[model samples]
Target: MQLAQQRRAFIMETVRRDGAVRVAELVERLAVSDMTVRRDLDALAARGLVEKVYGGAVAAPGTRVEEPGFDAKTALAGPAKAAIAETAAALVEPGSVVAVSAGTTACAVAARLLDVPRLTVLTNSLPVAELVRSASRDRGEAAVPTLLLTGGAPTPSAALVGPLAELVISSLHVDLLILGAHGVSEEAGLTTPNLAEAQTNRTLIGAARRVAVVADHTKWGTVALSGFAPLDRIDCFVTDAGMPASGREVLADTVGELLVAGAE
Candidate 1:
């Protein structure tokens, strides 16, 4: 096996560039055994150079600890979020009340709601509320469900979050909560950089009969400033095909259901 420091350096750089590195990939790249690569990854994780996940290591949280603007985030994982949103939108039944949390993925979910007959969408996301409203009008869907927005302060991510938003969300129960998070991991569950957003999400989750989280693979293994929900609280998780093989196994056993869109 290569010297520990050298192996770790290569692994760290790979994670930095690719965002993540699978154990098997590392093993091959380093001409090392699986155990050797895992040991190097563990050492890197201990140094905060990487974040360990089920079968791989990801670049440690950096600026991700500070939430990015909505437009910035929408560009990072567009295809994965789009696929996840498609899977999550399938969960909404016609005429059901759905509460969508603020995030790019949740907005994607809202974009698909125009076709669902009589879908009442209550949201803390300014973008989601507006998207559903203007899209409904644009499509001229006569049976569009009622739309509700929480009254609160706006965050950089275009989320209305604070006491006012919580009060409004807490008072109303919805058939489902379509959620988006800054990060998600088995260790952290669901997390966000903003504390107000965390509290608002918790309130929304409490008001829902079922909760579905839509996030891309990039969100995995990342824990931000505040965690709002545990894996057990999620009724279903919809992600893209890019999720690591290790994550699929863990989520299958942990969540009520796991859906990977665009997977063969």
Candidate 2:
């Protein structure tokens, strides 16, 4: 067991330093048989420390696998998130049912949704649920939107996830789903570090007719551990004008409708 542990650690370090590790190189360095090296690589891939390719393994995308808590995430790119949220909120029509996933950007979007009369919201985010509920109360009886929250274990991001959330989302459908992501890329699509949240987000997507992803410029080119939807699955994408020209060009060709949010 000690030998195996040391081998895996060495493999991970090599991949980290070089960005990838070939099977032949690992076999030679470890002085092990080809089969033994392959087994070690397989074990590392399963743990998500590296991504297995045709001939070798490369480092997985994203800065880290573990996600930061809600407060930490909310503090980053606050202005950009607010601007994107405002633009995304404009898409919700009166009486439309909207599903909101967990993320700082989604919470911002929920804050802007109060003006839409007769809107019904379902959410897996505790912050989003509370915001909508409070906003509904402030709106009085005329514009009070019905709010529903999924019952499940709460993540560090305050998202209700697990089987209970998926079960509830599976039975209902919504007009739109406002989703947030840890990372977005042409290859990885929409991704998050928490696997359970990924499954919960997928259910949210399955329950919605249209999917709108709200992300800031920082998310581009990042890839998280679990992917919930393909890039083509997004019906609309709203981001701040700070998005890089290279990303904008790629997104313009791939996404359905790319809308850049300006400072408002």
Q: Which has the greatest lDDT?
A: 2
Tens digits of lDDT, candidate 2, 1-264: 238767876776676568889999888888888888789888767645578898888887553456789999999999999899889999999999999899999999988887787888899999988887776577664676788898899999899999999999999989999999998877778888787899899899989999999999999877666678988888899999999988888788888899999933
In angstroms, the error of model 1 at 51 is: 11
Estimate, for each residue in 1-264, the C-alpha lDDT of model 1 and write its tens digit: 678756765665566568889998887878989988888777666645578899997778552445689999889888888888888889999989999999999999888887788888899999988887787687665756578999899999999999999999989989999999898877768888777889899999999999998989988877665679999889999999999998888888999999999999
lDDT of each: 0.84, 0.85
Clashing residue pairs in candidate 2, if any? Answer: none
Q: Residue 251 in candidate 1 has what lDDT?
A: 87
Where does model 1 exceed 4 Å of error?
A: 1-63, 139-141
What is the lDDT for 90 in model 1? 90
